[model samples]
Target: MTHQTTPTMLDTDVLIVGAGPVGMALALDLRYRGIRFSILDASDGTVVHPKVGTVGPRSMELFRRWGVAGRIRDAGWPGDHPLDIAWVTAVGGHEIHRLPFGTTDTRPPLPYTPEPEQVCPQHWLSPLLAREVGVHPEGPLRRECRVDGFRQDPDGVTAWATDLRTRERMTVRARYLVACDGASSSLRKAAGIPAPSRHATRVFRNILFRAPQLRRQLGARGALVHFLTQPPALRFPLRSMDGRELYRLTVAASGHAGNRDLDEDALAMVRAAIAFDTPLQIVSENVWYLTHRVARRFRSGRVLLAGDAAHTLSPSGGFGMNTGICDAADLGWKLAADLAGWAGPGLLDSYDTERRPVAERSLEEANVNLMRTMARELPKEILLNSEDGARARAELAKELERGGVRGEFEAPDVHFGFRYASDLVVGDGDSDSDSDGDGDGDWRTDAVPGGRAPHAWLDEGTSTLDLFGQGFRLLSFTDEPAAPPTALAALTTAFADRRVPLGTTRCHDASVAALYGKPHVLVRPDGHVAWRGTQLPADPGRLADTVRGAR
Candidate 1:
């Protein structure tokens, strides 16, 4: 797409291209920071296939922080729909392995967080975000506005975007430009950043259709996702979306008619998974390449990348969008700090340093999940069974047991246990200390140095996440008189004087204290702990400087 230069000039603090989930998330973060930004997308506001379904728990925590967790939770998914993931020979046939997670209604109360993940597919999610971000003809979120090219100077970035409707070109100048575009990010390619693939690419097809009565048809057999383990072609999920009215069937998109058309064979593969006679309307079919890749670099001068623009991974673990949400959170604060004039020169650089490794880890994990599924050996006997199917069923069950199918669904470690090793993290002397708090620890270290602050229940129906509003926070255990040592008093006062929003709280509860590890924990506006010490520093001014990116 070439740029058509025009006279109209638009200026904002930040300009975001591609209104995907990650882009919308960046806009939301910028809005919370009180920064002016404009978000644009090439397509009109409608999500047809809904590639992403389940939001991870950590992403849900961030959603809680952003004040949209409740709305997202209530986004029309049937409250009673079973969240269990079942692997079977067919949708209603020969069940192999099942991870019986309760429905949204019956889930046991979690100790770490008040908000668990919600199953709102991307189509439903996108509209909710669009409404919250103000989608209008001329608003910040301008649909059908395609970004063609951009140039960056030391001061700011000048982008050339075309209005698809009027065929008019407009220039947008902003302090920074973020590309939340997908894996085939033209913006990243335009900026000369290469996303080298780590694994061989494979093609997949996502078939979205409306099966309003399929839920009732399946009756007691209804599940959030049904992994079809049938033969050579059908072995992916037929997932329910929008309260069972809509469904998406994923299948391998190779060894058949090319991408130009969807062959009847593929449709038949889906039909075999549906055991009941139900009304079905084929909505949309999407053919996409699944890749395991990480960008050579995440930032280019005044331009930065987020979401699939920065990295692309297989969708096995469902970490693609959640990782991007984290990227948005990490970059949003640094941008706001830089614009507000308190961030250190090193602050912006940390974005790439901190997020790139996380993406790499996610890439590897997703690839592993993909391999586990792809490498499953389906014996000929299992595929072609006759009258006495007992032997075939026994063989299939044994394969499922050894395959560790449940690993795909229960991945709390991938979502919550990742830790960041950056210059910002003040490491304890031991190298093992970094991985100290893995799993459900009372006090697990935040993965990103300035990442999402750990979640802890502070009171009845309240979370420690609720404590962080739009500014920095300081948690000091009053029970420990020696905690925020007298030396750090000056630094605390300096933060107060700088007009940096800071919330100070003193907790005496043994559980909360044990979780925090240190007596004094200084959290950033975005809720990641910036500086934590068993005891306060001797020089409060230096502590303030360190927290303000002045190390």
Candidate 2:
């Protein structure tokens, strides 16, 4: 497990470890910003079994910004396939409850966002992002490269890595290092960051199989997820993973009778969970521990953590990968700013300040979803095929309605509602600024400072979000030309004096103004409102410095 050599030196602007979706996302953002860096992944960039299934709406928005949303949407998951969630005794067993979310092609357009959620598995997503980051021998991405250790000094970090194929030792020096490594992050551990568990750890097994005829057999009754309700046998989700032949059956592996180890008794247990006589081909099986952990520190010195390295949560709400992608988007711009010689010292510090609390809230929300499934009351009579079984099933379906089952399926608030409360955010304490709730207004659609900039379609193809992510953009609501107001000339002057990148977009649309609720708004590169007001601030340079992390 050890390989040592007189490591040759390689210099770069950033060094990223573990090329999962998170790491590759950071690389993509960095590439978009034209930042020079090297990404190291231990595996050969092949996704054997994708654990993550659905890309959240917020992540889809980020992927849109990264210019990969089209590829993902066309990544072969059918657009007309049913996107419903069904609860049943087995694959072809007694029905209990169902939540019907219309298929992608049939879903209505929403005013909130242009990009909706897509069913892109990690296997499809990872290689796509890797290809975007480049897989050539001389390119930025290095496969089969493992990080052995690293040392951080005053200037940057020097990471020691081994090319697994050749056992060639190399040392990479970078101005900053981002750890997008997975839950058991070697970089996170090496940096001495504490990732304490938030709840009791639970064990589970995922049985990945191929039932080529199951879709044809079900016909119009097919669903995205089938929550198995067979009491004491299986109570986990049996999901249609690929919209085709592939499926994943999540089974509890602790005290249940279905708790057979994958290597020893997987086939028997998988067979017991299926009610149909269709031919089944077991592709793979793996055991995973579900642990909810959030690191106390997202940044330590020049080293920063993103994705599962920064936090880990239950895979219930499909929040794990999306959360990590957001982490990369948040960190990508900050890293670019610092390296481009425009970011202040405090700008890097705000990454943890902004992202950590969002991680905490997301963890709690996902845990609540997990508890809902765990606390469901399953009775034996519900599984019977008699008339009593019909009554019991109907009753349980009504109970599910009362129990708030839709919260698990439709949660846009969890994905897009978190507001950042940090030193970098500039609040409007003016008469229009409302602070009615937990003070900072954690979740709302008001275009409040530190919240996500509200989405609105300006033209046939463009969104209000399409205006952000290049640099600091000043959204001038007036129909006037793209010129700084006489009152705001000081802000423009201050930015120019410091060589900061800023732009002014003059929007005349009344609907956009209404959604923004401010005459002028300063948006960060990550598409969150940095500051908002009807007029320029009294101390524009001070506001500029604060937002860029100096104040």
Candidate 3:
């Protein structure tokens, strides 16, 4: 007689390792595309000491697509809080320079995007996304589930994980696996991907505390961030985390160049940064190493890396998490296409080709911000009340202005100006789509191939961006008494024959047509322009195949 044992098994179209914001963003996108996937995380989905403070505008737009942007906007941050960035000697001390960004309620409407950036810390954001991804027992997200290892074969990937609470063994099989396991990703190591450091690592400390009465005491003088210019000890940012009582103060862990003060007192630093005595409680202290690392490759066999796993940059400009979210958006639709059996041989490969460059560029930009902050000179005289102190403060302010410190806070191009260049994207004449920023100030209107499609208002409350989400979209611009070109019929038939999901929209607005700079535009599911021209190609099937990564 032989005894047989049963195996606990799970199967999905895609298996996601890690449930941080980046991983959850991917889940949101996959859910939007009606795909089956599972997210595994070791933690219980609680963010105690949040690292990310503000979501960038591009990430907010993607969150809008995922149907949670409104929820994030309503997640307890006050609407009337000042959105300014101030360089001060300390809180309630001498104001060196101030970049005034009006409050959310008073800021002028931006013409480029419908959704602006929002201040949603990870603690508030994680729970909202977890609920959206479904946290039930039968749901796609499995918290307290740690994946130990995985193996890939010709058919799919098989992962072994253990429920941390029960210590029970389980197996997960999927066609593809994505590792959003963060900067110290073990799966990335297991896959033999090398993420070499691009800059020397430095350790910094964050002190999270609740100063209940601090906001009331400051009154109209409050700002979103107070960049401390204190000499030798406190030269980092003391930020308002929740626009409420919670705040975080960052400092160099080593004090000075050779101080070696690893056991520095946390409360002492906090008090030194605050000029007035107030009721406060220390919540937690975190010491994190800042490293600049980008993986040599984002994919290895069937396993892919995203978020901090693919690239880890300084948080000086808040680009780390936002870049990872964009990575998820780019990969989400491609994975769906592959699962639906419509992906070309080169479609999945374009994820690496398109996103790796963006990561490198963002890493460089973030590092520049970091170096600027690190190189700032905080003379001891800047803290005095004498005329020399005032002179020092004025000189530093002038230097900051000359260095363009405001770009770190007010860079819309950093958020929305990256263009993808790959085999899947069809470029027009002399179109160098690899540029990272808006060179000619036309990023908001130019529908350049391999870039995000331009946004225009179709009506009072609707934007042209609202037209494309679930699949490919074809926009036809026709003036009055002029019908859509005859070539549209051929394009629609060609896409239909290949079973590709394509939506067609005909617009008669001359202004919108002029903004697009073309009579016909094809937008990908991720909202990037695939191709735009005055007339469709004679071989519509070839155009469809080219955009689908088949040609």
TM-score for each model? 0.93, 0.95, 0.96
Over the stretch 1-551, how does candidate 1's per-residue lDDT look in tens digits? 99656556789999999998899999989988899999979999788678889888878877877778889988899889988887777776666667788899998977556677789889889999888888855458989999999999999999998889888888999999999889999999999999998999888878888878877877777788888877656788888887668888888766434544346554565677776566777888887888788999999999999999999999998999999998898899889988988776777887898789889988888888888888877665554456445576677677776777676776767776665555555654434445423334323533223335667777876778888757777777657564535544665677766645566788787777677666777777666667676666667666566555667
The list of candidate 3 runs beyond 4 A from truth reads 1-7, 255-260, 430-438, 480-485
Error of 1 at 30 (Å): 0.9
Given candidate 1, what's the lDDT at residue 17? 95
Candidate number of the best TM-score: 3
lDDT of 2 by residue, 386-422 (tens): 9999998998899889988788888777788777788
Q: Which stretches of candidate 2 lie over 4 Å from their true place?
A: 1-6, 255-264, 430-445, 479-484
Candidate with more favorable, higher lDDT: 1 or 3? 3
The TM-score of predicted model 2 comes to: 0.95
Ranking by TM-score: 3, 2, 1
**Relative to the unseen true structure, what is the Cα RMSD of model 2?**
2.9
Q: What residue pairs are clashing in model 1? A: 419-447, 420-447, 491-540
Better of 2 and 3 by lDDT: 3
Higher-lDDT candidate among 1 and 2? Answer: 2
Q: CA lDDT, every prediction? A: 0.78, 0.85, 0.88
